[model samples]
Target: MTETVKLKNITIVLNQPRYPENIGAAVRAMRNMGIDRLIVVDPRDYDLEKIRKMATHGCLDTVAAIQRQTDLKAALESFHYVIGTTARLGGQRRTGKPDATAEKIVSISQENQVAVVFGREDRGLSNEELRLCHELVHIPTAEFSSLNLAQAVMIMCYELFNACVPSKPAFTPRMAQRRELDAMLDQLRDILIRISYINPENPDYWMHHLRQFFTRIQARAREVSIIRGLIRQVDWYAEKRYRDGRRDERNRIMGKGAAECD
Candidate 1:
């Protein structure tokens, strides 16, 4: 039987994996879930024999097809949306923002070329590396949150595998892409600055909150277009009113000077 074509578009990336065995086992997990693309970033020099020995079953083909990259950023360059798997928060992550779950990850994967990054075996992802991701995900564990690298890959794949079955009611809105959303936000930032909604001295602070609020809302592309159009309208009206007010003030002054002459 031919392999199922589920999750055909999702690319799995392993970053700085230390063990050949884990790589081998990850192939099996991927093959089991019909995930064909595997990207490895700066992995240790591993013996293919060691990898093959650990990759039991008919998963050798998956092992053979692994793509190598010098760094995680290079590996993920093509994917528009990336999800980083980490239990701990790092860098400039907003405080107390909950992680996107497996379901949430799968939800975005429907329309986007999603790349899910698994960090190094020893320390997980560095804060700088995590910044590359659009979101972070964690598998909920009771006592021990740290899952084995292969185990983590398996869990994510399994969840994706189960969740990716053809959608039933089919009324889901097309989610806005990062590029599109970022463009709208850019326009919004300019309008906000024009209106003085953003503090001139600390624009980043105001924008940071607005970004968080909109990111939380997860608005659709159509929805974001509406918001952007509204901002344009507000700017248009504000300028018009300012011009009209200036004209009326000039007329009043001219009339007062005529009365004084009389």
Candidate 2:
């Protein structure tokens, strides 16, 4: 059958937003949609007088509790997947990958924490920042497709708010949290290093790819535990084999044998 992940599961992340008015309006858009979390990355200092004035009534708490991060990547760490808004289409789109619509975003949220990222008013999301996103969405518009920052936020928020209804799917498993997923990734990375599958000095080579791999799948909490258990077993075997191999070589070199035989 179908499941439902409500609008509460959604988050709005603004990257380097320059305008206090736009930020205030974004708060209203999110509040209107029943989405509460607001994460702003490297925001410029704006006068509270202007911001609160634009925020209107009942939105001050959101402005106060709003999270601030140094950059987009840091802001995105806790999310299972990022839906970055971008108008530019080059580096990432070189493979001809198209942007996702809001419906697809909702569908993916069935078992993942979805962060909808809007870039700065001047440049939109940088190409480097866009790479961190699991997918991108470009709101369709007439000629002069560039939309105002608040307008972009409003449209994306509207879609997610509405999509939480009958269209939402039914998911039985409790989804894995950010820290739990990171734990599994760390465990697997350690095992891979023990087995010579990955380099210890540069762990992120495969770790980054692994993160990308996991983001696509709607892996549940139980699934993450299962994978960690499996990795532990593999680690045990790899270490046991490697020790035996070392002992065998030493025995061959000397006229002696291993103290503990395999």
Candidate 3:
């Protein structure tokens, strides 16, 4: 049964990718690693015909199955666990040590659908986008933040392929999905707003800082989900109170007692 396990359940999500050759090379990487699915979100919309030549033979099927999404968050929701690639480090980004990252990937990759995401060559995944992922993978390099898109794709897929074939460990768990994490972030933002810790108009300013804080913890999906559930319960009670208070005010104005209204 372990031998039957495939890396095919993997989805490589490229966000706003600008180059066609990179897309072609990513397809080739997927082919090499036995990953057939590709999801490109709002890419530069390069000519697939031109890119096909770069994929060589027997790998165009990956390009054929490629699905374009309007955004990264939407593309990632179908995946149970998402790992975002970054070059930045020291704050929430998994840095230095391929062995540790490989173990992390295999542990999560073994259970359910997983998507490894990369951002545009220029800016990389935004802080908000990174928050949607379960963990971050920062490829180690020398004194530079830059990496070629296709090269990064190849390295990551290669690492993951190595993790898959060895069957390293017992499967651990299915993590919180992208949507669940997004919901938690939204609630956390709302709570911060309520506490006056963050201004609604400039919420992202604080959120980005907060995101850096959370990433360092390398939270498991269950842990984050538990926090989200607690936040929702609090939000629900607060909202119920606000609405009831409004009803009471209306009752008093209409000469119907609040108790009678209730």
Candidate 4:
């Protein structure tokens, strides 16, 4: 049986785009690739005539997408995975060969809304900026590795479109939502602290250890939720016992005072 996939919620996020024409071309490219959603963050000009003219039919609804964002980090937090397009190398290359990345995306294609991010024309995504992505994708290129903004989008979209559909169904892995992952992380920390395996006061040391451990496991969404539930139960009992002990100590002090007065 052939597994079906549709591009219902794929988003193209342009971060700090400098050229109006580039934005227009990107929109056009997305329209060609069957991508519907476009998110422009902190672009130079929202009302550029050059971009509007180039965008044509696709520009109608998407022209208003040009938005000013104070926090790009928060904006990306909800996405299941982020794919950054870059012609430049070194700091921005987050690994995975072109075919490998395409395979990875195929596996996690419909898990959540995927964001294909493009950085400014002059300089690509910063190291800190690229860190938000779950995996890094590089368009296979010659030594020169320079592609126009719209061309980059076209390449990524083509690969994505191709990757989403396969003759033999790929084994898709379920992933934890960002919120669920966050909760699991909190629970993990609390459980360790409660057990005195991790000192709450000097959390940095234990936090590093915990991060390394969890990184190895690569917990899925359902697995994370189940583990969190177990931790919550442990915390509930620990808290109840602690309160009861405090109450007992108070009663004992009061009873001794009453006897001494008598």
Candidate 5:
């Protein structure tokens, strides 16, 4: 018997969804693809009845088990890996094809909780929300390019499901959760700003590059802790140098005043 691909660790997250019907249909698609976990963040209207109607009786369990949160960041705190879906591409909105992205997801899912986040039906994930995702997956479409919310979810889920089979599992270490990585980045940003390494006015612009570097390396939890420790040491050294300089300046001024009195 072929070992069934287990997707219990993968979750579907809808960020600021506007319609109950779309949520329902997304849940139906998830169930069909054997993905049971669903999280909805700040939905405009969460009409469970309407969602259930679209999901039909078959996916009632998926709808019933939906997790609701007001904040997208908080909803993603515990996840080890996050993949955001995008329709528009340019600037920092780099995207990977669904099939290739699914292979990476499968590798990471072996040892971590992966969340595939989809944005609102009208507009996709905001730039701020996309920063939280380690990777972005885009479904290729015709020039028209606008895809229904449920349709996007189904295509992504299908690619993930298909990629699971015939792919041997590789050992991927448990990566740092979003919360841990965010904390480390916060400290890093503050230190970089204090040292004039990054512009204080818009620290996130430079920090985005750092975020990409860390994501590419797939930093582990212990590595995050080490980076935070290094930040603390840099903070201490910078403070010490400033204090020493201030003391030396004061002493020189006092000596000059004494010579003038003489």
Candidate 6:
């Protein structure tokens, strides 16, 4: 008997959703697809009664268990992997198909908490929010690409459900959580700025590429620690060299003064 994907480890995050009905319907869709965890961040309008009406009594448990947050970063801090759903694609908004993305999610879900984030109904995830995601899933459509919030959730959830198969054994360990990665990135940014590797005025521009590289590798906790350690060593060495140079200059100046006095 093959093991199935860990659906319990998967969470659906709705970012700045505007309608309670859509939230309720999204809850129903999640329940149908066997994904129970739901997190709502900075909702524009949230009414329990209105949500429950659309979710129906059958999905009361899911609606009741929904977690609410005021910040997207805080909501995603504990998750090891995050996938953002988007319809528009260009430039930095590169995306993967739902099926392929689902496979990757299934593998990562084995040992990490995974989150699938959806943006507001009017406009999808902003560039800043999308930056938080390790990957993006785009549901293909005709030239007309607009999709309802609930509909997009249902489709992604269905793909995840369908891909719940025993993935091939790989080194998919408990990867570093979002918070850990963010901390490392912050440290790295400061060090890079000190060394003039990245522009202080626009450090994030270069840091974004480094973040993408780390995300692509699915860095583990130990790996992140090692990177941080390397960064600290670099910082220490740079400081030490500067101090040594200053000391040598002072000695040279003092020696010249003594020679003149003699």
Candidate closest to the true structure, highest TM-score: 6
> Per-residue alpha-carbon lDDT of model 3 for 123-239, expressed as tens digits?
898877877776678777887657798888888777777754354466556665667666778789998797577888989877875665554454568888789888888778878
Best by lDDT: 6
What does the lDDT come to for candidate 5?
0.90
lDDT tens digits, residue span 182-252, model 6: 89999999999999989999998999889899888899999999999999999999999999999999999
Write one digit per residue (lDDT tens) for candidate 2, span 85-141.
Answer: 887765434221123355565555665677889888988877667656666777767
lDDT of 4 by residue, 1-262 (tens): 4443446546788888788888888888877777767777888776668878878865657666654565566666666666776655574254655555655566566565667788888897876676555556667777786788788887777666666456586654556654565567777787888789887898655675455455334457778779888888988898999999999999999999999999
Clashing residue pairs in candidate 4 (N, C-alpha, C atoms within 3 angstroms): none
Please write out the lDDT profile of model 1 over residues 66-160, one tens digit for every residue.
88899776677566566788867545564221232545545555555777789888898887676556677766678757678988888878777
lDDT of each: 0.73, 0.74, 0.75, 0.70, 0.90, 0.91
Q: Estimate TM-scores for all models.
A: 0.62, 0.73, 0.76, 0.68, 0.94, 0.95
In model 6, which runs have C-alpha deviations exceeding 4 angstroms? 1-3, 166-168
TM-score of model 4 vs. true structure: 0.68
Q: Candidate 1: where are CA atoms >4 Å away?
A: 1-6, 89-100, 105-107, 164-262
Arranged by TM-score with the best first, the candidates are 6, 5, 3, 2, 4, 1
The lDDT of model 2 is 0.74
Model 3 error, position 97 (Å): 4.1
By summed lDDT, the worst window of 10 consecutive residues in model 2 runs over 91-100
What is the C-alpha local distance difference test score of candidate 1?
Answer: 0.73
| Residue 142 CA displacement from its true place in model 2, Å | 4.4
TM-score of 1: 0.62
